[model samples]
Structure formats: structure tokens, C-alpha cells
Target: MQTLRTDVAIIGAGTAGLSAYRAAKAEGASAIIIEGGAYGTTCARVGCMPSKLLIAAAEAAHAVSLAPRFGVLPHGMEIDGKAVMARVRSERDRFVGFVVDGVHALPEADRLVGHARFIDDGLLQVGEHTRLHAKSVVIATGSTPVVPDALSGLGERLIVNDDVFAWQDLPRSVAVVGSGVIGLELGQALARLGVRVTLYGGSHGSVGPLTDPKLIDEAHRLFGEELHFETQGRVVSATRTDEGVTLRYARADGTHSESTFDYVLAAAGRRPDVANLGLANTSLELDAHGVPRFAADTLQAGTAPVFMAGDANGVFPVLHEAADEGRAAGRNAARFPHVEPVARRAPLAIVFGDPQIAMIGKHHRELTQGTFVTGAVSFEDQGRSRVMLKNHGLGHVYVDRATRRFVGAEWLGPAAEHIGHLLAWSLQMGLSVDDMLAMPFYHPVVEEGLRTALRDAASQLDRKG
Candidate 1:
């Protein structure tokens, strides 16, 4: 076998791996990145960009359909499924091209196109040929979609988020499994595009990033009114048919029903792709998620010269988080014994459904009872939302009772994506609730809704005092 030595070796050439490679190289270390799959990131190819493209098309269609409410009559509003998928695929390929080009620009000797398996803590086998003796290693192998065994029988009829962008045209019907971000976004978009959609949540109480019971209830009320979402049951059987797949769903109330759809899209979430890496051969310990045990602050795996980052670590799966972790892991791996822990940014996540959903900082479920109070504002009555004829959603901001400081927030509203960013920055900067309220809010804008929520919080604090 061909053997080589390097100061650092990074597995998987996706976001985290790429970031780690750059960081290691910047640290004056010789780093080689190994990959077994496509060069483009999950975000560029499957996760974020392409999904947003589809959502954009769905939004356009939905907006045109909603235009009649302003007393303006229109005609020729037809949604061509083939045309929609064409734009989505075309734009998606453009994004992937950019990522692949970036990879190609890197030194060819520094990139290896093969799967890497651990031979030991600092030793690895790439594909069937090369053996690498890395002084330190970073496992950034990312994650893969988790398909339940019951749906395994249907072969060609089953699809994942990756498979969606490859379609030449939108299907007539789809059965989306799971209520996570992917399921909710895809199912809602497809439904907006005039596709028959039935969303089956594996079980109730397991929706997207929102953990507060109130936000969860708001999600159920807002989304249930717009789409055919089922959270009270699970799919038990899937069988391939000539036209599509047949699904058998068992309800929580002990009843069963069957239906057929052109496709069964699995959005059940993903798992770290670390199982076959021969990690058991190493001295490193594995975590509960089956990844190597690592310090969250340093990304160091146990006491070994190994680090785990990105989706492989299962701490945070978003792109920005992956990039940050990769940077830290790579720098630390290069410096080794002199490694230092880095402070993490505040948590932030957004779901791109109609009336976008967002959460920043600690989730509602993570907060201690009576230590914090919630402030709320309903966009249904907010002036700007009403003026725009887009009045639908709720917002809640959490504040610490003792210090009256801004803590976290969950909102479902027209401009939630933007609001989430503002809140995330506030949390990261450690801004107090009074500090947020003191900021200038332009009159008659959507941001004024945020001011309203903050004012309510200030009033509550006053009452508590």
C-alpha cells in the first residue's frame, strides 16, 4: 500500500472538513483532506441552498395565489411543475459548481478522493491503496439520512432530500415522513406548488427546533391550518406499486389507514456517518451518539490526538456551526498539546415555511422554571403585518427575571429569519432586555413588533419588582 505522512489528516471534504483544512494549513501544518464522495458541501448540494431554491419557487407560487386578497384581480397564474423543478435544479447546480471549483483550486496533492478508515489513532487507510500516518486527525465525516426499517422494502419509490433536486419535474403526490425542518419545509413547499401532500410526523411532540410548548402549539395551529399534517401517528408499512408506493399509517388512537403517493420522501433526520470507520481499533472512547468522545470546547476526542467536528460530532448540524467547529478542531489538532478551548456562539436556527419559524439561544424546554419570564406579540394584530395582508404568527422572547436580561426567543412570523439574527446577536453579546428595548425601532416596520414584545417584558419585570 502507498503510504504518506502528514501533520494533520481530515476526513470528508464537506464544510467542516474544508474549514479544518484551511485552519490547519494556516497554522503552518501540512494537511491532507480525504473524501469518499462529492466535493460540494451538504448545504450547497442538498441541505440548505437547494431546499431554499424550492422554497423560493413555492413562495412565488403561493404569493401569486394569495394576491386576490388586496382586491386586485389577476389572470394567467399557472404553476408549471416541470418549469419549477427546472429552475430549482439549474440554480442548485450553479451553487454546487461554485463549491466544486473552490475544492479544485486547492492543491491537488493535498486532496485525496477516497474513504478513510482508522488503522489506529494517528494511522488511517484511504480506500484500498494509501496508508496515511497523520500526526493528528480530524473526523469530519458529516451525517446521512436515517431511513426507518419499515420503509426499507420500497426501493425506487423512496427518496431523501438529496434525491429531490435530481427530479426533472415535480411529482403529483408525495408522502413526507417526519415533522422536522426538512419535512415541514418540503411538505409545505410541495403543497403550495399544487402537489398532493400528506405529512406524517413519526410521533407527536417531535417537530422542528422549537422546544417551548407554546411555540410548538403555535406551530401546530399555524401549520395545521395550511397543510395536511399528521402528528398523531406513524407509518408502519410501505410497499412498491406500479405508479408509486402504498403507505400504512397506524394512528395513536388504534386506527389504521392506507394511502398511495408518487413518492415517499423520508425526512426523519440524520445520524453521524462514523460507524464503519474502524474506530473500535483505536484507543479513543466513543460517545453516546457513537462518535468519538470529544471535549465540546476543543473538539478533542478523549485524550487522543484525534478530534471530531461537524455533523460527525452530532453537537450542531448547521453550516455555520460546522465551519466554526472545523476551524477550532483543525487549529487545535495542529497545535496539539497547546490546544485551547473556544467559546461557542449563541444557538440559532430558522425553518423556511410560510410565516418563517426561528429560535435563538436556549430553547424553551431548556430554561429553568420561574427563573425567566416570556414576552409575546401576535403578528395577527401587528400593524405592519395587517397592512401587508400577511398577518399570521406569534412571537415570544424570554428574559431572565433576576437580571432582566435577554435570554432566548422563539417566533413564528413574517420576518422571523431577520428577527432571529438580531436576537442571536443580542444573546452572543450578552445584551440585557433593557438594552434591547433602548435600541431604535423604526416606526411602522415589522421590527416595531419586536419592540412591542420587549415593552411587555419590561412591564412584567416592573410588576415582579
Candidate 2:
């Protein structure tokens, strides 16, 4: 077998792996990256970029449908599903090519195309022939969508994110199996694009882990208008028929129901792709979910020279978090004995459905009612929402009663993503409720709704004192 040596070896050429490779190189280490599948990162190829392309098309279609509300009448609005998907795939491929090309530009010796397995600590065998010895390694193998064993029998009738963007034409009807971020976004988007969509969330009735029960209820009320929501749906079995697929599910009350759809999307969640790496050869102990135990701050696994980053660690699945973790892990792996932990960013998550849902920093469940003050504003009457005809949502802000420091915020309203980022930055800087309210509030803007919430929170803090 061929033998090679490098200062750092990165497994998987996705976002985290590529980021690690660059960081290690910057630290004056000779690094090589091994990738078994496509070189483009998951976000570029399947997850974020492609999904957003579809959402953008869906949003355009929806805007035309809602144009009547603004007294702007356009005739014969029609959706060409095939053309829409064709455009999505075309754009997605372009984005993926950019990432792939970047990898190809690396020195030929630094790019190894094969699956890598650990033979021992700091040693890996690539594919069938080559063995690599490195001083340190970073595992960023990413993740794969999880389809339950019960749905395995459905065969071609099941669709997942990996294949959804490649469909020649949209399904006539689809039953979405999860109400989390992916399910809600796609389900709502498909429905707006004129497909019959049924969404199932099991018993919790929660969408995208919104900590506030009020926000969950509001989401159900709003999104339920666009798509059918079956909160009690728990899948029991699935069968394929000549027409499509039939799904039998149990309700929270022990009742059973059956439905047939042109397709079933298993947006249940994803699992880290760490199983084939032969981690058992290392000192790392994997959990039941096949994730290696690693320090959140340092991204190091135990005391070994091995580090975990991105979805492989199964900590935070968002893209920005993965990039941050990759940089930290790469730096520590290169620095070795001089390793130091980096500070983690405050928690941030967003679900890009209509009236976008978002959570930043602490969740409502984590705060006690007596210890924290809350402020809220309804978009139903907000000036900007009314002007934009998006006047149907709510925003809430939380602050420490004693210190008036902004702890967190959650909102289900127009422009939630933009508002969430503003809150995330403010909380990261340890800004107070009053400090946020002191900022300029532009009139007839959605952000004025945030200003109103901050003002209310400030009043609550004063009352507490």
C-alpha cells in the first residue's frame, strides 16, 4: 500500500472540512482533504442552496396569487412545475460547481478522492491502496437524512431532500412527515405552488422547536390556513399502490387514520454520517446516535489528536455554527499542545416559512416568568405590516428583571429573519432592553414592531424594580 504523511488530514470535503483545511494551511501546516462523494458542500449541493431556490420559486408563485389583495390584477396566473424545477436545478448546479471548482484548484497531492477509515490513532487508510499518517485529524463527514425503517417499504413513493430538487415535475399531492424546519418550509412552499400538502407533527404540535407555546399555537393557526396540519399524526405503516402511497397513522387519542398521496416526504430529521469512519480504532467513544463525544468549545474528542466539527458532532446543524466549529477545531488541531478553547456563539435558529419563525439565545422554556420580563407587539395592526399586507403575526422579547439585560427573543412575523439577526447581535454584545429601545426606530417599517416590544420589556423591568 502507498504511504503518505501530512501535518493535518481532513475527512470529508464539505463546508466544515474545507474550512478546516484552509485554517490548517493558514497555520503553516501541510494538510490534505479526502472526500468520497461530491466535492460541493451539503449546503451548496442539497440542503440550503437548492432548498432556497425552490422556496424562491414558490414565493414568486405565491406573490402572484396574492396580488389580488393589493388590487393588482393579473390574468391567467399559471405554474409550470417542470420549468420551475428545471430552473432550481440549473441554479443549484451552478452554485455546487463553484465549490467543486475551488476544491479542484487545490494542489493535486492535497486532494484525495476516497473514503477514509481510521486504522489507529492519527493514522487513516484511504480507499483500498493508500495509508496516511498525520499529526492531527478533523472529521467533518456531515450527515444524511433519516428515513424510518417503517417507511422503507414504500420504495420510489418516498422522497427526501436529496432527491426532491431533482424531480422532473412536482407531485400532485404530498404528505410531509415532520413539522420541523425542513418539513414546514417545503410543505408550505409546495402548497403555495398549488400542490395539495398535508403536514404531520406527531403529538407535540410544535413547529421548529419554538419554545413559546403561544408562538407554536400562532404558527399552527397561520400555517394551517395554507396547508393541512395533522398534529396528532404518528405514522404506523406505509404501503405503495399503483396510484401512489398510502399512509396509516395513529392519532394522539389512539385513533387511526389513513391517507394516500402522490408522494411522501420523510423530513423527519438527519443523522451524522460518522458510522463508516472506523472511529472504534481511536480512543473516542461514540454515543447511541453514532456521534463522537467532543468538547463544545474546543471541538476535540477526548484527549486524542482527533477533533470533530459540523454535523459530525451532532451538536448544532446550522451552517454558520458548522463553519465556526470547523475554524476552532482546525486551529486547535494545528496548535496541539498549545490548544485553547474558543468562545461559542449565542444560539440562533430560523425556520423560513411564511411569517418566518425564529429563536435567538435563551428560549421561553428556559426562563421563569417571575425572573424575566417580557414585551410583545402584534403585527395585526403594525403600520409597516398593514402597508405591506403582511399584518398577521406576533413578536415577543425577554429581558432579565433585575439587570434589564436582553436575554432572548422569539417572533412569528413578517421579516423575522432580519429581526432575529438584530436581536442576536444585540444579545451577543450584552445590550440591555433600554439600550435596544434607544436605537432609532424608522417609521412605517417592520422593525418598529421590535421597538414596541423592547419598550414594553423596559416598562416591565421598571415595574419589577
Candidate 3:
């Protein structure tokens, strides 16, 4: 058996692992990343990069399709699904290669491609014989798409988000199960591409349990995506026929219904992927949720130097937040780490449905002593909205009346992604409503919506006083 020693050992090569490796190197620690599959996991292989690429292409196709409605008699409107997939896949591969190169460029980090398991509390056994030991370890293995065993029996007839990118042909009709991030993003992407898409939220609302309920109703109205949302949609069953897959589900109403489509995409969400890491052999603790339990700041497992990041740590599974958490874990494992352990600040969540949703900080119910004030500016109210032809969204903000400090901000409209960061930065820096109002946002821009929100918030405070 070959034995190797390192300062830190990171499992998985996804966003969190890559970030943690770099941060460990920045702190002068020798680290190596062990990936079970190819160098890139979900984010590179299918999740973020590839999925977003397809979404962008769909957006383009949608624009072309809508040109006629705007009185512009455009050329023939046709989308070659195979050609689109090929181009998007090639581009995704190139971007993944670039990211891999950047990760490898770190001086003190090494990358290994194979399965790794914990033989003991402090040692990882790769393959049959090679043993790797480190002072600290991070399990950033991330999560995997969950397919109900009954539905999975349909096999190739059914697709998941990971398989959607490889589809050479578009389905004449498709059914999307689940209404989480993966379901919503991919459903809209496919719908805009001209596929007859029906989304099965399975939970009485277009949005999943993780999202605000109000936004759920808005999604159905704007996306025009058909939905079958009901309570008790558990244990879904699917079957394959000559046409395609037929899905049957039951709900709290005691009604059993079925839908047939040329393709069925299961977006039932994800569970942490840590099965083969030999976690059962170690004394490392896991919570009732079956996730590794650790302190939010230190991310340390028990009293050991072993740490957890990304989905394995149970924080929101966003790439940016994972990167930040990875940096924290990497630092906590090092001697001269940046900033002593601190709980993460409020995070920003951007969901890319028809009317995009972005939010940061505490909700109104979470406020204690402060008077809560909120204001919203509709996209229809902005000049830029007319020019850009984006009419179905709004920006809302919540501020503490006494201190003028912003506690929450949400936007549902075009370019919401770009505007969300401004709110994130302001909220993170504890900027007040007055401070945000004083800033000069360029006119005839989506950012003007922010300025208007602040103005309305100030007005609300005045009215309340």
C-alpha cells in the first residue's frame, strides 16, 4: 500500500471542493482533491454551466419567436434542437476545461480521479491500497438528483436535468415533475424552445416548499406552464409506452391521475452524495437529517480537524455560498486562517423562472423590536421596462423604520440577477434605506427600480410616522 501525506484532503471536485482547495493553498497548506468521477462533478458536467447555457439558447429562441408579436415580420422561426444541444454542449465542455485548468494551476494542490473512502478516522483509502492522510479533511461531495425508484424503473424513457443537455431531439410534449430550482429552470428553458411542456409541481403550488408561497402563484400566471400541483404527491410511479413515459401520481385529495408525454424530466430535488465515502466506519457525527453535523463557522466534525462544506454541510447549496463556506472551512483547518469563525451573513437567492425572483436577509416575521416597512415598484412603472419590453415583474424592499436599515430586498423582473447583487452588497454591508436612496442609479436602467423602491420605502416611513 502506498501512503501519501498532505496538510488537507478534499473530497469532490465541484464548486465547493475547488474553492476549498484554493483557499487551503492560499493559507500555505498542501491539499489534494479526490473526485470519484470525471474531474468536474454536477456543476461542470450538468448543473450550473451546461444548464445555464441551454437556458440562454432558449431565451434567444424565445426572442426570435416573439419578434412577430412586436410588429417585426422576422424571418422563418425554427429551432433545430439537435444543433442547439451540440453547440451548447461544446461550449459547456470548453468552459469546464477552463475551470479545471484554473483549479489545477494552484501551486500546492493536486487533483486525483478515483473513489476515496475513509479506512479510519484520519485516513482515506483510495481504490484498494493507496492511503491518504491529512491533518484536516473536507467532504464537499455535493448532491445528486433524486429519482424515485418506481419512476426510475422507466429508465431511459425518463430524463433528469443531468441528461437533458445530451438529448439530441426535442420532445413534442414533456412533463416536468417537481417545482424546485432544477425543475423550474429547465422547464422554462424547454418550454421557450417550443416543447409542449407540462410542469407537475406535486405540491399544490408551482413553487416548492423552500420558496415563498406568494411567488408560487405568480410563477403559474407568467410562465404559462401548465401545472398539476397537489398535496401528498409522494411515491410517484411512471411507465414507458410506445409514445413515451406516462406518469401517475396520487395526492391528498385521494385522486389518482396520469399524464402521458414524449418525455418526462424528474426534478424531484437532491440528496447529499456521501454513500461510498465509508462514513459509517468513522465516529464522525451526522444529524437526524443524515447530513454531517458541524458548527456553522468552523465546520469541524466533532473535535476532529475534519470539516464539511457545500451540500455536505447543510447550508444553502448555492455555488457562491458554497465557495464562501469552502473558504471558511479551508481557513479553519489552517494555522494563519482569515477571520476567526463567524456565522455566515444573510445569503442571496436568485431563482430564474419567467419572472425571476431574488431575495436577501430576514423576512418580516423574523423581525423583533424594529418596525417593519416595505415598498414595491412594478416593472410596468419603469421607463426602462417599456424600452426593454419586460412588463411582468417588480422590486420590493423591507426596512427597519427606526434605524432605516434594510432587512430584506426582493426583485421579480428582467435583469433581476444583475440587480440582486446590489441588494446583497447593501444588505451585507448594513446599508440603510436612506443610504440606498441617496445613491444615483442611472436613469433608463433596471437599477432605477431599486431607486424607486427606496423612495417608496422612505415615503412609507413618513406615512407611518
Candidate 4:
């Protein structure tokens, strides 16, 4: 029955929730962050950072192994899986330690490591006894890995993205259950490390904002994975065997098949973690997926005063996007009486695949009345891509024909992540084709293609005129 008071209460300490707390603090609002598990986040603990580290190590090992083929053998290439795992663990610990300490250092913020549930509209209960009351609450609890109904008791052996880094010994082979960003990224990483990978997905169609079908095909091809691409094969059941796990799958044509692997990873997707937040007590609405639905501009629950961000709000659910959205949501919640919602640009979705994919703004199908112009240049045409022998993938951009404004850009290449920065800037600034083309990007860099692509898109404007 202890009562606590705050101006804002953040229900998560992950990327989005943490950002929202800081945003509220910056506005001179008092806030307390209630974390269910550990501090840090999926990005810091399991998702982006650790996964990318492993992928980078795998790529480095692959590069060393390929050195002999390039006639540049330095010493020898040998992968001690133990050593790789040790480094991953040590790095994760150091990084997370820093984050934990930093969270504690926030004088404006208070932390509670316990699961929280809403007792009433403005009242929240945490752990066994602590109760808090706040004028406004932000739910940035993020999402959790989805284990399909088909796989029930196949725990431990049937893993997800979070379980990949927990391995003390590497599996010789693994069957990845989804071809989405995390699945493809993890599968490619394992493949590069000499682990046989089989990727299964029901649809070959693109899912994320980087909605390019060709890039996905390139991923399957480059990894040489057993791809159930463009298929109706969905996992029906999983059973733990004496050695590994057996996956039963059903195709669209009603044919059934089975595959056994050292491990089966369910990377299908994630659901918003809104289970015990007590949404039933509030007027806040939820989508069909049982996620809170909020106004995109304000990140408000439409119930005013109450806001949701990150995966809870279902904006983009990416770590970066969550942070950005959380900040906006916090600002709006604290100053809703004085501020008006403004139109922000669409988010960019960057996927780290074999040939990384970076996509931004609207796709060809998303445009309503704006005429679309597209430009594509293969990585084979770039100097750096040639030097690195990464002559696959392509760089492309879309522009509105009327205003000549950049609508979107996508790259599948070594610098796809870096190129995403340029696209994000262009979209945020509403940069015209001419404005983007004028930027002095370095020659021989993948960014040089941005200039060319923008110029090409601009030329289409002239042709139409």
C-alpha cells in the first residue's frame, strides 16, 4: 500500500523506454523506469550488438579462410569456436556492465528491477509490494520472440535469436524457422562460420520496410542455404529427439515433410510485451495482435495523457526507431497541453544480411499520387565493391517525380548500413534530387553511388517535364 508519485512513469528500461525517461527528464519532469528483467536491451544484450559482433567475427574468419583463394595466406586459418564464444561473452559483459552503471548514474531517473502491472488508470504495482502513481505513463516494454503453437514442449533445443549467443559449443547445423531480418542475418552468420544452415519460410515476399524481393533472393543464393523460399511450407510441429530436434512442416499443396537438425531456431517474429500491463483497466486501445495502438505522430494512446512507445506503440520496433519514437512520445506526453503534433517522415529499416539491405521511406506500392522514379546501380559498378570482390547486390533510390524529393533509397552491399544514414537524412530533410546529388561524397566509396542515383532520379524529372 506504499504510494509513490512521479510526473512520468516508464514501464521499460530497454532502448525505447530508457530514451523516453531521459526525454521526460530533459523537460524537467520526474520519472521512474521499471524494468522487468536486466537493464541494457535486446540490442545491447542479445539482438543487434551481439548478433552483429558474432556476424563480424564470422565474416572475419571467412575472410581469413578465403585468403588462400585470394593468394594472400598470412599464417593459417583455424576457428576455435570456444575462443569466438569467449570473446562474444566477454564483449557482451563489458558492454552491458557499462550500460548498467550508466543507467544507475542517471540522477533524474530511478530504477526498479521487477515486473509491473497497472492497478488502476494512473496507479502501477511493481514486484510484491511497491506501488507508484504518475500523471502520465509510457509503455516501451518492447517485444518478445514468438514461439509458434506448433512447437510447444520443444524448448531448450528449439531456440530463438536470444539463444544463439548462449551457446558454449557451436552446432554443426541449424534450421532457421523464418527468413525475416533476424533469421536471415543469424543464418548467414552461422553459414559463414561453416555451420550448415537451412532457412524455411512460408512466403518469399518481403516483410520489412526494405521491401525488395531481389535482395532476399540474393541472401538465399549467397549463403548456399537450403531455402524453402517462395513456398507454402510452414512449420507444423517440433519434437525433441535423442540427438536434436525434428521439425514437421506442411507445404501449401498439403504435402508434409520433416527435417532434423542440431537446433531449430524460431525467428518467425516478435510480439509486443504487453501481457500484464493492465490494459483492461484503461481506455487505451489494442490492435489485433494485442498490442497497444497509438497515434503515430504523438505516440499517444488516443486516451490523452497516456502514451506508448517502442514495440508497444508498434511504430517500427527497431532499437533506433524505438529510441526516436520514445523521445517524441515523452515530449508530447509532458507538453500535450501546449504542443501540436507535426508530420514526421517515415522510418528506415536496415537489415544486416550477407549483402546488407538498407531501405527508407515509401515503396513503389505505397505511393498514392506522387509519380515514382527509381535508379539502380549494381555493386559490381562500384570501385570499393570490386576491391573487396563483393560484386553482388545493388544500390537503388526512389524519388517523387513532381517535387523531385527523395522518397526512398535501398542498398544491398558492404556499406548498406552506412548508406542508410544518407537515405535517412534525405528523407528527414525532404531533400530534393538536386540537393542530394550536390553532396560531396568521397569517390571510390559506396556513397558515391548515392550521388549517381540521385542524379539519375533527377534526370527522370527532366524527361517527364
Candidate 1 per-residue C-alpha lDDT over 7-32 given as tens digits, one digit per residue, 9 for 90 to 100: 99999898999999999999999999
- Give residue 17's error in model 3 in angstroms: 1.7
* Residue-level lDDT tens digits of model 3 in 336-355: 33335745766788877656
lDDT of 2 by residue, 287-341 (tens): 7776778787788887878889898877889899988888877888888856777
Assess each prediction's global lDDT (C-alpha) against the native: 0.89, 0.88, 0.76, 0.76
**What local lDDT does model 4 show for residue 263?**
89
- Candidate 1 overall Cα lDDT vs. reference? 0.89
How do the predictions measure up, each by TM-score? 0.97, 0.97, 0.91, 0.91
Q: How close to the true structure is residue 295 of candidate 3, measured as C-alpha lDDT?
A: 71
Q: In lDDT terms, which candidate is top?
A: 1
- In model 4, which residue pairs have backbone atoms overlapping below 3 Å? none
Compute the lDDT for candidate 4: 0.76
RMSD over all Cα atoms, model 1: 1.3
| RMSD of candidate 3 to true structure, Å | 2.9
